[model samples]
Target: MSQQTGSLISCTFVCLLLAFFAGQSLPVEGANILGVFTSHSPSHLIIHMSAMKALAEAGHNVTVVCTSVPKVTHKSIKQIVIPLTEEEEKQLNAGMTGMAKEKPSIINTFKNLLGSLSMYIDKQVDVLEDKRFTDLYKNKDNKFDAVVFGFFFNYYQVGLGSLFNCPLILSWTSAPMSIVDESVGNPELIALVPSMNVAVKPGQAMNFKQRLANYFGTTLFRFIGFYLETKNVVFYDRLWGKIPDMISYDEAKKNVSLALCNSHAISEGPVRPNVPAVIEIGGIQIKEKPDPLPQDMQEFLDNAKNGAILLSLGSNLKSENVKPESVEKIFETLSKLKQRVIWKWDDLKHTPGKSANILYKSWLPQDDILAHPNIKLFITHAGKGGVAESLYHAKPMLALPVFADQPNNADKLVQSGYGIRVDLLTLEADEFKASIKELLQNPIYTKNVQAFSKLYRDRPMSARESVVYWVNYVLRHHGAAHMQSPLVHMNFIAASNLDVYAFLAFVLFIASLISFVVLRFCYRKCCGGKGKPQKSSQKSKVKKH
Candidate 1:
């Protein structure tokens, strides 16, 4: 009996010990995260959505409040879609269209967008007041550990971070521009680094015209930024009117902890300095392996006697909006080519005539299509996301930039030796045909892009991996407050050290003045006083005579 009892005791002790270790081994629950993206642009939403999905997959409960909720499979992600009104949609379309048609001058583009900026801000205010955001705000038990804001022009909505008492993160679709960099207290380096809107390469020195363009672009961007910030203060006042713990517009921006930019040095050149808070997760949308192309797409590519070409104008523009003649010219050129063509056309009825070699689709799986071994060239609108993807795939491009960053992207692609640019507005069949023929016939474009693709993909960690690592890194450290630049906390005078320099200058000036007075006094006593005595001596001599 005693032996049995001893055995039982030993077994029980072993069980208890196992249970203790097992409990310790289990992972801790992740912190809750909130992501606010008010912009209705699909491209911007993709970057933010990718981040939210990464956080959710990392065992965090993520709540995304956006104008349109993206499709996410993670169980931890909660999406709240704040839909845009019909008129707001029209305004958004108009803004893009108008900017595309703006005069070639950078200043004129900024001037045109100024009126639309206020309307965008007002729409964002509606997002903050939405029942979904209000419910989260009012719910005493609902707390978030961090908040991520889409860093479009909507700097005002960063106040959500303060309202929720959490760390704020800004996600962008491109590298940090001067305005975005300034918000995080990063150096602008206006003379060296090309403006985000310009395509000057890193190694190349800017010519007089390029320098002029960079300066004008940087100035115009800042002018618009100031106007938006000024407008934001008013909208924020109405948004935060009743809250007892109100944070000012300026204070809210300073609290931003990290900026996740969609840029990599290999593809997007002109690499410049960055603070620790700025993280580049370029090509985050790319998958480790391309998804299997649809059956029809697979068959289409397989059946092509010659290599295929993919033409996409990106998500924002409609094919119907392109002038009919321009469409006809593009088709006229493409139809002559023996290679198969796949174009992203929204309207089936408004296509650029039918051709045996051309396939028209309302939407194409762009990344997958580009990945196919048979695709020889990509004719694109030069959107940044598309540009990044094409670089990753190493496909030669023929850029037909429509508007916004497209012009800049197209210019850089040409500079990089990867492609040629044809103004979509002035595309002639002859020029379009020649550009397409050149990319296909020459091996240099293909060689340059393929070399770049290797570099772009040869990162220590993949873009998605970087995103997941940083999201958890921030959560582990409880906000990267150590990474925040001192400049963010400093006033203009203090940040520039102008006050200290002025004090030194004043002290030096005072010392110099005192030295001059002392020297003059000594000179007068030693030289001038003796001269007066000499004059007395001369007068005595005169008396004697």
Candidate 2:
């Protein structure tokens, strides 16, 4: 009896020990994470908030700082809303409208989207003053394991890192621009990687002209990128000025732990190198399984035996903004098609006009609709989110890009053999109709996109799983200081090793100068000495005679 009792005690002790270690790990797994997602666009918000949603589902206590309410939410997530006032709203819209009307280039696109110093910076600086947001850092008792900033070339968000004393994770909405690469010191080699505004086939090399354009684009990109972030130094300092354990803007940026980008390098073109600190989690905004379609729309797609087209201009560019004639061209082409149409129109009551073959809904589940087998083609503005969805579902696109990155995305679409791009501003009904017919008739579009779909979805871990693992990784490892890049710490001279080259050049110059002087001295001495000896011999001979 005593032997049995002792054995039971041993087992109990072992079980209790294991429980202690398990309990110790729970805090790391269920971290208190703070997320700042203050970009103004609705689509951009969805992409960033999706990361927070993943954290909440993983049992983290996620508190988000955002401009508007996020479409993605979780029970464990709490949001602090600091919406823009009416005046700021007008300023932001005016900035967007002004940029859209400007000339098109990679630099202009940068300013159009994430940049334009005055628009994004001034608005974000205002966030620093909002009491609701300031309260997070002001309180001494509050703590967070990490701070995930929905990045947009703005540096003031770095203040969250200092305030919370945690690892910083950046959530970028699209592929790396030169500025995005600067965040984690990820290299953006223009030779190997095309500009974000430029697209090539998945594994193709650039031609001479492409390389030349890329060089110019990359230089301007770096300048604009540096200007955009460096311009925010005043606000960054002001926000963290009096706080304890304050760090300089430069130091704060260097300490950033990771950048979770919304792009798949392999599936998307311009495949490039990445540091350990950078990860691609594109299509995280897409649902795992599509929700059921609403009744009328369900029947509409159900009976689309000839297949159907899904059209959306994205949330940022409204239907009203579209030229009335362009809208007419789109409607005219779509109405005449044998295929059915599901258009995302903002005004249901005042749609362009009635059509027997078209069903217009003010709001639609974009990805879910794309997932349907009946969805033959997607006509979009080529926004990042829409592109990800279409790629995920293997649906070809008829791109009618308006502004910002849409044109670049359109370039990628045609380049991939999946779709064609037309000028939305000058769309003709004949051209629009012909492009749709070409995509439908051509089985290559379907085959090519379908093949890429496999590459896109074939990942070691799903996007959400990666988000959970990495976020927990940072928390458990205490700010993940080891994951930082050496480049982040280096000055421009050091990063490029320009000083090393300069020293080598100086050494070569000194060595050459010494060799030249020594040769000249030796030549003069030998020649002059030989002539003197000959002259002396002649004098001696004459004297002897």
Candidate 3:
């Protein structure tokens, strides 16, 4: 009995020792993350949610603050929903739909921005006032290791990190523009990297005129960003003035440790230098294996004997908002095709006249549908996300750009030989039909896109993996300040080297004046300070007479 008891005791001690060693070998727990994405656009929300899902899956506790919840969810994520008002939704929809129809200019764009800033501020303020959000600050024990903000010109929200005294991450759903780069003092080389609003063709060098457009476009974008940010400073003061550590929006922005941009140079070319703090996580939302299509969707694709075309104007633009004439034209063009068509229509009751070749659905899995072997062509609105996906799948496109970045995105596609662009506002059935046939019949488009797909997918790591690695890098290094650019701390004069130029100009002017004085003195000494030429005695006498 004594020997049996000794053996039991020895085995228990060995088990305890093994457990301690196993625990030591295991990975450390992930840091708690807070993601704030307040954009009303579902497309923009997807980019933010992708990152959140990735972080959560990597064992981090993520808290999301958004105007609407995304379809992508994970067990580690806790959402704090902030709903938008009816009027706000109407305004956003109107702006997106209307802008595509109107001609874009710097003046009109600035005016639109002024109008939208107030609405965006109002909507975001409502989110801040939500009880759940305030409680994050109210409960001192609710510590966050990092705060990731989905930046959409709302510079004021940087204060959230200040309130928590945590490291901050800023994400841009679109490509890196001057407005975003300037936020972190990243270089905005206008000569090389064109503004996001201006579309430059692939491999097309900018002429004086194109460069001028880029310069003005970049300048105006920066000016508008500054104007809006100044207003947000006031809003920040009014809203968080009571909090002792809350800093000005400008000051708080400097605390941003890193920025994740949804852009890849391979697809969106004219690659430029980025500061260490700016990381590109483009195509993060794209899945290695697209989600399985629904039963009806799969069946529809299987029935497409002549292949299929996917037409989606993106989530924000309701198809019903399309003019009746344009809708009929789209239908007429599709009806003539032997191929099947999948259209994303909001109002199934008023869909463009039904055809045997057309399939009408309120929503389609755009990426999944594009991935199908039968999908030969895509007609899209040129949203950055859509553009990225199409490029990733190597699917050729016919862009019917609506508004915002759509036109620019379309132009790049055309330039890249991946597709063509048609004006959606003034689309004719004949022209629309011609464009589709051109995209399908032209094998060159397919070839170019397929080549690009290889380049886009050739990366050191997947987009999701990049996000995980960088986010963890920030946490591990306590904000990774070592990687931040020195430019962040510089003012405009220092950043642009205007002060150096000014000083050099001053020195040049002073040297020129000294040289001029010395030359004049030398001339006088050489000629005895003569006012007139004494050598010309005959000419002098003739003049006197």
Candidate 4:
């Protein structure tokens, strides 16, 4: 009995020793994350949520502070929803409605920013002051490894990352722009890379005029962004300035660990330059296998004998906002198409006069619907997220661009021969119908887009995978400060080497002045000395003669 007891004790000791070693070898616990996505646009929210959902799936604890409730969320993620007030909702809708009527140009778009930006800023400040978001910091025990923010011209929100003393990960919904680039110390690249609001053809060279327009458009918009940021400085100081050991807003701005942009340079062109810190997860929102469509939608799509067309103006569209006449024209045009149509109208009770072939849904699974085999053309507002999905699904698009990047996105789409673009505000029945028929009849658009889709999906890792890895990487490396470009910390004078150039110029100027003075003094001294002797000697010679 004693020997048996001794053997059991020895075995237990061995097992305990092995367990300790195994525990040491196992991976550490997942990091805690905070997501701040306060963009007024719902499409921007979709991209931000997709990225946060990825982090949660990778075993991290993610807490999101967003203005609107997300349609799709992960079990592991918790949300602190702060919806806009009824007044704010009206203002946002009104702003979008007013914007849709304007002729879509980079100038006109930015020309309208000042009036609408304040509303967006007011919305952000309101979200910051909310008790639910404040409680995260009020309770001292709350800790986060990183704070991911959706970049909607809100630089002040970087203070939250500062308040948490964690990495600030910025999320941009389009390709690199001066606005996004300036945050992470990326070069302006204005010569080659057009602003997100200005679209250039994928592979086409920019003419002098195009380049000139890009330069001015980029500068003016950047100034517009800077102006808006300056206005938000007060809000930033009010909320985050008082915390002890708090990093300054300016410091936090330069310290952004990285940015994840929803753009693929390979598929979407003007191949500029990028720093290591900028990660392009262009089609991050696209699912590898799209979710199953609604039974009715599935049936509708399955029954599409002639290919189908999808029309979505994105989250901002409202029946009341769309001019009735324009609606009549659009309806008259779409109602006559041979292809079946699925219109994502906001109001189901009173849609744009539905036809037998048209299916109206208040809400749509856009990505899933695009992935359907029968979807031949996507008529969209050309928002980055929608364009990315359509491109991923290899569906050609007809863009009725209204404002922001839509006009630019439309121009780029047309250049790629993917589809045509028409002004939504001035769309005529004949033109709209002709554009649709052209895309449907042309095999070139379909062929070009399909080939591009192959390249888009050929990434070494998927966008979701990229998000998980990079977020963890930032956590592991303590903000990945080394990957940051030196430009982030540099002022314009220092970054442009203007200071060095000025110093060199001063030195050269001083040297040149000294040389000129010395030469002048020596010449005068030698001439004066020699002249006096010659005059005196000639006078003496004249007296002797």
Candidate 5:
């Protein structure tokens, strides 16, 4: 053979060998991911889909076990849909529709109660003993390297994690890390980013009363959550069989190897007690190709000379339900404004008669709309998803928070100097107009938002990449046991030193007694001689007489 031909064959042989080794070095061919997401909320679905996409791209087998089918289309992932019963579905639909009259008040609450009971029963009876659920564990045919569970209201995911006996990671789509990062003791008080002092300087902090209110708000939610979950476990046991001792906060916290929060450092400040295992992989949606706006809306934005304001209440709130009076006020305010308005009013029939500059649509491409050069302000409900997107786009906001964590989110936004919080319940046309004008005219809000936007976008790695890295890290480290917190079993009082009340009381009592004795001694030393000597001499004189 010629020398050149022999060399070519050798090079090809080397290439094939390298490719085979590279394939072997990869973690595994398939990663079976079990994702539990909020059944009702699209936001959770969106986040789960994003993470699933990233995992799929990384060549991991992904199986999502969520309450409902998500919006995203992915061929690589398998979805396990758990359907709600007719009664449960009714309650869920009622909650979503805001139609309390259609069902008894106890229905929704009872559903949660029942769910907790059911889970408890399942655990006690070992009802999940069968291969249907535990099949993932026993099959030994297909071992899962890691399990990812959503941190929604349901605790069943944690139970499922226990069943699998694998490394578990929590994917929190909310702003506060308290649910997963319990080290800080108090989730609400611990600001995610302690460094950014935009509106309220750190020193000029919220007073005790305000802090108490925040604490109560979070604590109340947690208490109700626990009660509902426990009830579900009990109910499940009665219906099926006794479930094992599978559901526990301590177990979940201890077993969870890593936390993946859908938050960025720029938008969500530094989480307390920063640990290597807790990863903030926010702005996942921004990583995707944003849905585009209609051409007419684009043309309108292009033609607007004074810039535009984008108004949206997210997906849950039906624009139709907004009181007509509030709508009138909004229209009255918007019509007079010099700036053009692009409002996402799903049902526009109820909107006030149109103005030359005002536009209404069933939906708007929020990210694209925010990114538009002509868009100046975002009127949002302060959903975390919307707030994160707004931060990414660098658009200041007029936040009209309705419910849930939105009010708190708005407070953060206003405090951060990038938004204004307008009370939705008692909105006034004139006040609304004035606030909108102020936000538009104020250059600082724009400047601050733009600054944060830069920080949000200039991360070391994209949110998707960060999530993928940690998911793999958990698998590679055999569930990353080193990352778990040691104080998993401690309660609030024990963890906070409130459990030392007895010692405190003893010290206080001793201090009080010592103070009383000192005071008596001092009284005698200062005033006794002046009155006593004369009394002794007078008594002696009287007796001699």
Candidate 6:
């Protein structure tokens, strides 16, 4: 009996010690994080991967649900490949390729329309309704502290966060514009308001009309995007039982708890109206040491004793689609240039000559090449990744923007005096050569770019940390209800229209009433004949006349 009692006591003591340690260790355990990145764009991929790695470093379990359409590799995060059906893949490819061609066919237009619909319904809805996602929520055993939705164009990912019943944080892979960051209270500047406009440099004040145009332009874009999102939501509601429509701004504002903009105020210049909830976390994906250049690339960079020029039209625009005239111009222009050129011409082969001055590659380690000492000028299509990388590396650029946000990025770069813009369609070989030569010769452009780079990098904290902090804030606050904008919940006209017409009507009515009263008094004074009452006959005569 004594031996049994002693053994029991020992076991009890061991159990108590284990329980105490377990309780203590529970506070620091890993958090479950679900990051939805549906955009096939490389920039979106980079930003999502960077944030995922950061969360992992902070002892969080991250699961990324992305499509294998573009085929990206992320080691730290568990990537679930959402494969596209063959027909859907063909339709999508047709849209992208067709858009680049001269005058899209009716079939291409139809395909694009179908593609958009499928993106909203088939791709997005299918992913959300998958057994893996449903099981995650239904198991009751699994829970996520937060869900990060990173996408360039699609707002539907916000639905996944709502479905998971976790804090929703939006990561925008573009500059902090009013439309996306409006909920967070950041209003884009009135481009027409010269005083409100943040000049790119001294003595370059934007006129009031220009400022107003910029403001309205951005607002219109946002409104269109919001409209499309709402339509998608309504469509989804009809198909799927009233699941929360995350695409709607009003719905997202209510459901989405946090906003993380992938931009810096400094590089984007000054925004007239700033919102507290809209956190600027630019250069979030700037890796300390990016992957090394491939062997062929290293050899080319090594051979270029003179500085090399990097020319890339980005991932979306194929070099083959470039007009033959433009191609000849670019090749001719590059041939005249003194600097060696490394062009990412994915589908092209056979150089104009054996000058060994130009090197061609299908894929290039862009960041690594930018960081190289011998790389002087970056001629690019002004995509977000290239823009961010150029800014991060302090490299000046010759921006030949093709489509979408590339034009905006290029405009900002040129307006900031950090780069020059060349219209791809109208560019001549001599003009292209001249601009490149000018940019290379000018020290101001390089100096300005480096200055911007300093400000972009000198933030209070890393962008990853900012995102993590906000995500934790949402978790700790039991949903960041306070961060949401009341405006997002209001009707579009009420929120943005500002009732200017109503105010004008009210003012006109008051003015007309005041004028009539004044006129009546004046007539009485004139017709009274020095304080004597005017006869009814005089009034009748005036009326008849």
Deviating ranges (above 4 Å) for candidate 3: 1-28, 104-110, 116-118, 522-526, 529-545
Question: Would you estimate the TM-scores of all the predictions?
Answer: 0.90, 0.91, 0.89, 0.91, 0.72, 0.77
CA deviation > 4 Å runs, candidate 2: 1-27, 94-103, 110-117, 532-545
Evaluate all candidate structures by whole-model CA lDDT and list the values in order: 0.81, 0.83, 0.83, 0.86, 0.67, 0.69
Residues 1-545 of candidate 4 have per-residue lDDT tens digits of 69999999999999999999997555434899999988777888899999999888888899999988897689989999998989888987887788877888877777666676457766787788889988998898999999999988677887877788889999988887776888889888767787655567787668788888888877788688778777668878888778788887778778789899988897788787899889999988899999999999999999999989999989866766777888899889889887889998887888878598899998899999999999999999888889889988999999988887888888888888888998889888899988888899989999989988998999888999889888878887889898999999899999999999999999999999999999999988977678988999999999999
On residues 426-464, what C-alpha lDDT tens digit does candidate 2 reach at each position? 788889988999999999999999998999999999998
**Model 5 — which ten-residue stretch has the worst lDDT?**
190-199
Query: Where does candidate 4 clash, by residue pair?
Result: none
Q: For residue 82, what is the lDDT in candidate 2?
A: 89
RMSD of each: 4.3, 3.3, 6.0, 4.4, 8.6, 7.9
- Point out the worst 10-residue segment of candidate 2 by lDDT: 96-105
Cα lDDT, model 2, residue 254: 76
lDDT of 6 by residue, 1-545 (tens): 69999999999999999999886544333778887766655656776667777777767788877665323334556777676679876655555554554232223433454454345234655665667656666687878888887754455555655566777777777656554655454444455222211224423556666666556555555555666577656544543345443344346455767677777765455544455567677777776676777887777777787788999888756666577788888888887667889988776565434456888777777888998777889999888788889878889999887555666677768888889988886778878988998889999989998988887788777887887676666766767777667765666567765687788889999999999999999998787565443566678789998
Over 365-463, each residue of candidate 3 has an lDDT whose tens digit, in order, gives: 788898899999999988899888998898999998766677778888888799999888889988898889899998999999998898889999899
Tens-place lDDT digits, model 5, residues 1-545: 99999999999999999998996567644666665453455666777678878888888888766545676637888776554457754554444344211221223434433442233123322323323445555576755667776665444445555656677777777644445555222233432222111123223554555555545545655666667567545543443334464545445545667777777644456424456667788877664455666899989999999999999988656665466777889988888888889988876676667898899888676777887888999999888888889888889999887655566678788888888888776789878988888888999999988988887888788988888887887887778667655445577777666859978999999999999999999999998769988999999999999
Error of 2 at 455 (Å): 0.5
Error of 4 at 24 (Å): 12
lDDT score at residue 220, model 4, on the 0-100 scale: 83
Provide the lowest-lDDT 10-residue window in model 6. Answer: 192-201
lDDT comparison, 3 vs 6, better candidate = 3
